[model samples]
Target: MSESARTHTRQRDDASGATTPAVPGTASFDRLGLPDGILRVLREQGVTVPFPIQAAALPHALAGRDVLGRGRTGSGKTLAFGLGMLARTAGRRAQPKEPLTLVLVPTRELAQQVGEALTPYAEALRLRLATVVGGVSVGRQAAVLRDGAEVVVATPGRLHDLVERRSCRLGRVRIVVLDEADQMCDMGFLPQVTEILDQVRPDGQRMLFSATLDHDVDQLVRDYLRDPAVHSVDPSSGAVSAVDHHVLVVHGPDRYAVTTEIAARDGRVVLFLDTKHGVDQLTRHLRAAGVAAAALHSGKSQPQRTRTLAQFKEGQVTALVATNVAARGLHVDDLDLVVNVDPATDPKDYLHRAGRTARAGRSGTVVTLVLSGQRRETSQVLADAGVTPKVAKVRSGEAELTRITGAKAPSGNPLDGGPVAPRPKNHNAPFRGLGSTKAAQGGSAGRPSRRTTEARKLAEAQRAARVRRGG
Candidate 1:
């Protein structure tokens, strides 16, 4: 059968044609016109059944129609678009700077991950895929386009840069997929997304998938999608129902200690902090406690972010300290624990952060640290998200914290109820652009604030001490 006919048949048979099913296995990939070579690669990768998002959206996506898929993290949206890319781009004619398909994501990590997910399927069709995101040389990406890439997975900013430089063009692009649309909106990339979409061929197929259909997401659908099919899956709580939720009320001082215990787990631990500085400090503390860890935020270069994720995925780093940038598009399977170092302000964020672990029907724990002052906000989040967390006073360095979070034992609390390690004042380190010329001028503009200077000095001192110890 033709791809569009097959997809139409599958959609007609689906009870979730209009509404997304809250469960998986409603529609098989084969029914969605997934080519044999793609199926073979999927089998080799051990991805047999489709997730709910995939089951609901694949048919429409494969049928050459715009689709808006609403599903949470770990709901298998990546494969949904991957299948679409493979089906649409296979046997298509294309040239350098003219890709048949494009996938835009919020972060570099997600760009790489989406690229990885689509690579095998594309390869099965004798197609090449290129990943273009920030933190890497634009010349390299321009060269990749010059060399010819069938599909491109990229972040909006980097892709925009390439377009502005006339290194690539999407005039002939047949398909465009935006993964984690809400997160892209949350990161203030909606304008960029719109710009990129505008540059694409107006008649091209488009699919936008996200966890919640917020105002920002709604805007994209109205602006970019044409007669789009909307499919939402089991939206009772969040995208992931497999996660167990917990809210621990701890003293402000003990928060760091509690965070460290959770970070020192045997399996993969994703800890979400509120700020870049906090993540950097937490990463240092966790590493000093002998836990293999890395940090993901805008502070790190694109290459650094990529390497950190690779290490975490390969088990070289068991714990990953991050901000919200890693909360949405990051798909690390079998993550044992997710610690919300800071309370979530929005109901959607609560759901997305907790969804990091407990993916693919696997049991995982979601522990949110609630300071006394944050009780009100925390309670509001749980109520809005329809989750009742186990609330109790827990010490960071205690076994109860580990038991609640499913984290393993640590030899000792690295902080010992002491001060959290400070970030360093290195000329090489990146700053958050705090309206201060000191950062821009490197040490010449002026001295940083007392608090800032102290933190920087502490970081430098720690590094010096580490060097002295031959670490």
Candidate 2:
């Protein structure tokens, strides 16, 4: 066979026997056996065209068959499963504490995203939806469940906690979808996943979607899914054609400076580190260097994380510093740049971090910084992931950095002539002062800083104005 023919043959052979090929040309939601309400919702969302994964998986899923879908991030896997689950349980009424459909995700962020994505469709169908995740009020979640939520999107840990507390039950679940199954396994949620699956109705339909079907995922498939129609739309590595990858070799001491320059660039940028502490420290360093940046990690409360993400998305913060927790299934639109401040420990992590950009056919650039001590390991990681990026030995404020990442030197002044304060552990506490805890407690030599004095004067003026107007 010719090379092209051989590639086609492999693509045709990747799926299981029960799989059906997707038709070429743009496919519409109406042609895919979806109901009128869902079709209307899709139109309202301006989704007139369906992506490859949705086209391949929707047919079997809508036909009430088990489906194992494999697709990269940002490939419309959420809609692929979400639409099917909603269509299957459209007319069903959920009893208190027992949902008709359950969508399991790997992280709190993903749960929130998926719920937001599906809410309009559920509302159009007159279906009540609830999101259950940890790091928030369980009482609120239980109240929603008690009031009867037909569709529940949740993270496994919080769902399991609710199940154990008898606040939520799985006995009436008619359809279950596991989105991002590979990530759930990576986060050590397989046992909890299996436990939760065991409680669902035995005859319910199941759909599992993942970027890759490794050994652990295969085991879950064997144990839970029955005669599933498998579909693989894109490669698991998430190396989209629109993204350009580069490796920058830098000196140890210059690493932070290079990263700061990149983050200070014009467009929105997401910089990834290996640890939560690294994320916090880098965020502080970037803010101190006059870049508007925010940190997101597991240690942050749910509300703080949400606020940080909103800030980044709304352009209030130009760069977001995060750990691997932000990698999978977190979508931010129009993000053109991603930087790996610390080289990912493995290829999978690298790909997930890079997937944050170049999404949905938008052009993006991903740059990895490698110091002398990490060159060999970084090279091996890239090779294993089948990515061959251009390597350059660069320094801070060099032409190479500018040419590759559009990084320019930043003005030394802080963004607003004020420091970014460290995130408080208690979400209810007000931010007392900028950047310094000691200053917040008491200024140096018992004298307030100029900014604090100005803030007090402004507050007093506002209060006096309000009092005079009222009394």
Candidate 3:
């Protein structure tokens, strides 16, 4: 963790978790006091050494001390807090509708990711962990809660709905975690996140591996976390020096050509667009040009979004065209390139989008195609992010663009319509966006799941039946 580790463990009582005297830590997970079962699981997964954030936070977390841990994306934040929560909830028989541990994330992708990361450990400890996110069947999530689950990983908005329906209870939750606290707040989940936290046990241990511990997340720390043991592994912004940051100046008329060329490059790459409309437009163009592109945004159903990601990861889709939804919590293997087709308006968005690459100590490049009118603003955003990128004026099919991003011309022929999954005919109608307001509730990016419509109708029917039965 040498190159990746710029960490310091501290303890503070103030609202702003700042520097203070050092908190002692160990280098190994076993030495940090993780249970044997968890250590064995880690070993089985070939995870031997602890990341800096994990080393700094696990000691406090395992001891039930509230922890505020901050690290760059892909820095083992899940393991930092998840192991302790699982250990604390182990051997406990949760009553139906009441979980012993709660993990609240900002997105459906993140909830699923955290669940997948923690599953083996929970299984080793004999704990049942449920991931509750919108986009799929609400009845399935409700049934899991209705039966029994020791741990629940969720997105706030859907969790609120479940609570209102009385299908889940937070009263028994003694360990609460907010995975991306800053993103949760930025996405306006603060009220619901706070509401959910308030419902958990008063003395519950809280931990976070946040994107930023600056302004947006301060309220969460002041209100929920007790005089916590805090760890800041990276700088507040989480920008890495190893990443190749580039700002490519492109003329508006040449933008589409440049984008298509990059998408047609020989390797897999993620192309970021600001809006769902733009993402779809570019994806369709790429497919027509035989680029094997897929679109991902909040306007797609959960299953559609899930399938898109699977295709991207499995190499079935060569180009991933997306919006801010995939900016956070989406991890792909060997993904060495990310092209910001539409420059990010905010520094955090830029950082998160750039984070999709350069993960796990690998070399990656972030290229932002800036319009002529966008240079000044994009420069300011980069300055705010503390990154000095390699700036160059690039045009479509130019050698400079090719050198920087491996850009090349696409095939004249169109793909056979297998790159991006075809929209479901019988399920959700082709939503220009993603889910129903009710089923797609929360800060989740895509809005398109017919599964949500069916689930909502089922819930309403169940309630109507309950009213008739007087149960």
Candidate 4:
């Protein structure tokens, strides 16, 4: 191992005077031998210092060695793998339908996010990038691949579909990244992931990063990786010290009302439910109770999901109700609260759900609502996950709720007179130099302008033509 590859550890003395491994420290990215261009981009992003995971993984990865990385969410794993891939493949040109690098994530949201995070750096490196995922126009994604993207960020299933359609070819891939490998397995996409990996060049360097490694992930590593360098920054079962965990025991009848009270609190909050039906139902309930909220799940179309997440991030919507699809690899900035409307059944699920908050050294709180029947199971789950939360028995209108979660009574009024309407399907029309006809005619009624109607029709016609072209 190189001096930079050595894990920097300090000894922590306990009450018995015995030492334990302390959290490791990381050297700067420049010290890891990244190119000046990549370093310049990091500096522009205000990322002068490297996170522990990045420091540990970057050295091996930049050297074209296979790496197995383990780090908790918000540990900067994205940049750890992303920067290495970009730097290694710098100045490489991709052939049509054959990418030079591939990043496989588990969800469409993650694919989009990974793309967004890497785009600026890729631009700085003068590399072309594309994102491929389901729940959107596959033809559009195929067109991007056909135009030749040097790097492709994708989910396994959608990439498989494109490959089958002859829109993508992996023969020239030089480096591959399997981010959130454990979550991909949990979502039952390992088979598709395996199939996709089978197509990549045998000499391509592989990097696999996950919070936990079970039998399935182990199998993938054994089958594909060659003498990988393994680096783990944090324990898989451990909780973030910055997060304050709490279990609120509510009566079954009062759960919905109490949840509404919590959602109405100030600031952006994420509420997790066990099922998509529950997510949609709670979103409606929260909106009805006068909280601006949105739902994110597989049931939502890609456009709808993208819009909802954008609204939440931009503070146009303050609450997001979602299922496990949002549990891993979804990075929201300064989000301080996460509510588990339904307690997670698995220990890893609990950790990932709570991982949404208390990220990047920020203080945050995670509250799990446990009903009477779920108390025992919830306790076991927490214990197994190495979390010892403060258990409280609470109900609606209690001062404890306000003290813990900043819960406040909602002003039972619609948000801007109910939900915001979807944007017009046609967004490419040339702007007319005239004001709305309603305002021009001295009518105060809120209605679509004639120009708006025309734009929509034109957009719809264009969409129909594209569909006919299979693009």
Candidate 5:
């Protein structure tokens, strides 16, 4: 397809996704200029309206101009670039072991997500899409590519591994997209990205999308992009407006119970914990509670990660308990809730975690479980991040929780029938000061010495102190 024709295809859809028909002076998809076939596909998929990112990047991305997009995760990035990739590669014939379009992402989960998002649109035009990542066997990906997939979405490490092993080639790649470029830098994947980019055709189209473009990302753009068009739809300054954030403070003993209650009645919940062990433990507990949950962490094997993600997306698992693994690259639709079991140490981490919800302007909730000790630290983080959440104590089985979550309480007490333990008065006794040691010696050990000395004094002065004074 011609570049001009491709650009027009993505820009044609500007309608809001609402079901209500457009009135006079109302925004419509016709304003953006998408093709009727693509529009039909979107409508069938219940995507009638355009998200801000999609509206902002579609036009330039489709035009085959190297576009730099600045938007948060779940801000319709996949569709934005997916439309661009589909529009550009529509008429191109698939070649064996060579892809016409390539999408580079940070993590395996994201690669699969992007592939899934674009698959339906690619299928409309009979374009093939293959996922290449490290966890699964590369042989399967090689076979799929050999069968002639037009597009390839892959993680940087896995994709580079494939290239080094001579399992894949990028000489025919026409469109190259680096989604979540900032995240790649954070994960130390720049070398892999640089290696992968060196192999792709230099004269081909390149589009880079990220939440924020820092020095490292700028370096990639300067070296890779050719007079790239920049589009900043919600830059760092603009990220907060798109997300709704809240912090819920609870007692230390009631943390897990509170988290379980919040996650139980969610739409799609990406529950983030501080550590991998937490992820595994939370997954087990949630599953036992009849709330289907899948654990995603670095400890899992590749196939396990892939399967867990599949179940999560398919709604077989209502909650996905994860560490930082799902923080950066994941883009899920209609994520109704984001429960941070442990509040993020910094505001940046908080923003990344909160970004999972409130994506695509669909309006979602972000509830963070802050135990007693975490209140001050988490409060500082949120304040620095410029987020203000309604602070309230969560009563485990109270009416407020019921109002917030429509689901009823589980049969028995969710706290494992343990009584709340009061904090010890001498909390610092284990590391007590010298005064405490001296007092202990004087009170017990010193008493015996004083009594023995006083016994001899009493015998010597038997009747010497018999006088009494009257006032």
Candidate 6:
């Protein structure tokens, strides 16, 4: 960002607000019609101010008006709708197997993240919150629902499954939230989403919030939301001003070398690839080359995915190589870089990947390591995304690569599958079993290279991931 542009950009903690074009003055939670308890909680959390989207939509939402909110990821969309639900449903009680408020997200990761984000306030308001998602113990989730939860955060598929089993009911659901609606559509969950929405109380309040508002998402707005007060804090754009975008064109042979260098950069970074197979492949290579890298994709068990993210946030893992699962809902304070080892297949994917950084008013960089073969198509995708990135033709061990990404040579001692050298910070990152990048190169217990065995296991588990698209 230039000096002139820097003056116009405002950053908000993604846990609070997202980076956005500057708006005049700041907005406070107390002035946004939040209940006294929520306001007190916000202040206690040091969040006296609300993000632009939150400031704009909370009034209508609290007034029982349907809301159609539009904002990029991390722009405080969670709290914008969350506070209203928590406030409006404050004094309500839910019967066994029936929830009063429902939040439907696209993926299991997102569902879990939202539930975690809202848990504190829900507790403050005496609401029991249940997170329903796939890949976990459905029996436990059913038990929670059977015991009754005032709020349920879920993915469309699992929630639908629960409904089919008669373990849960939607009749009592008075407030419905379709968060990341566009993603639900993109992931082909529209049919299931609409089915679930149909089962909810007909005249209940509805809110649809997303980064983009086209395609199947529009269908949802037309069919479900009634007379919504639409608020768009940031227009859908590929080139967000807060992030410095770059495309480093590299030779095919040096692609991995360049990527390894960037992952070995001084700070923590999220590296994106399009496929689970590719993510695992690169993760193995990075670990073998001595960088503390971890793989996050549908290939791993849900527990593995959860543990890996916790480690990454706590700095036990320096490099996270993932598919779109980590693209949204994953938040790390002060993460200044996101790398596209493989360019996104579309414009929306690009924006979501870029959103991982430049958060909370902090300036971040998104770097794409492009091969010669992919340059043209990648250019078209970026153009569609409205990003005119700084294009650089570079190689490994070069000054320009170092300048752009702070790339450095790997230690080459191979991580040996043990934990990375910890870089713990002040934040309260969760404690987990903490394991990623496999054991030392030699086989343990008849398993050839532990990293190799893990990689094979991942590849085997994900052989059909590209086709099935598991949550």
Q: Which candidate should be chosen as best, given TM-score against the real structure?
A: 3
* Per-residue alpha-carbon lDDT of candidate 6 for residues 1-471, written as tens digits (9 for 90 to 100): 224221122422324434544233236676665677787778888997677777777777787878787777677889889988899999899999999999999988888889988998999899999999888989999999999999999999999889999999999899999999999998899999999989999999999898888866768887887757777765677336589999999776566567778898988999998788778877776787788999999888888989999999999999999999998888888899999987887998999999889875678999987877788999998888878899999977889999999998887766766644332211212111112222333323335777898999999888768568854
Tell me the tens digit of each residue's lDDT in model 3 across 1-471: 464466777789685747577567778877776779999999998999887888888888888999988888877889889987888888899999999999999999888888998999999999999999999999999999998999999999999999999999899999999988899988999999989988999977888668677788888888888888878887855555558999998765566677778888988999988788878877876787778889999999999999999899999999999989999889997899998877888888888988889876678999998877789999999889988889999877789999988988887567855454322222332222222223344534466478998999999999999999996
- Using Cα atoms with residue i matched to residue i, what is each candidate's TM-score against the true structure? 0.81, 0.84, 0.86, 0.83, 0.76, 0.83
Residue 250 of model 4 has an lDDT of 79
TM-score, predicted candidate 2 vs. hidden true structure:
0.84
**Candidate closest to the true structure, highest lDDT:** 3
Off by over 4 Å in 1: 1-26, 396-399, 407-409, 412-471
Off by over 4 Å in 4: 1-26, 416-471
* Candidate RMSDs in order: 10.8, 12.1, 14.7, 16.0, 11.4, 13.3
* Best-to-worst ranking by lDDT: 3, 4, 6, 2, 1, 5
| Model 1 residue 357 lDDT score | 82
**Each candidate: what lDDT?**
0.75, 0.80, 0.84, 0.82, 0.71, 0.81
| TM-score of model number 4 | 0.83
351-467: candidate 4 lDDT, tens digit per residue: 999999988757789999887778999999999988999999987778998899888776676654665422111221211111122444556445677999899999999999999
- lDDT at position 145, candidate 6: 97
**Model 5 spans with C-alpha error above 4 angstroms:** 1-36, 237-243, 266-268, 313-315, 328-333, 401-408, 412-471
Query: What shift in Å separates residue 297 of candidate 4 from its native position after superposition?
Result: 0.8
Residue 327 in candidate 1, Cα distance off native in Å: 0.6
Quality of model 3 by C-alpha lDDT = 0.84
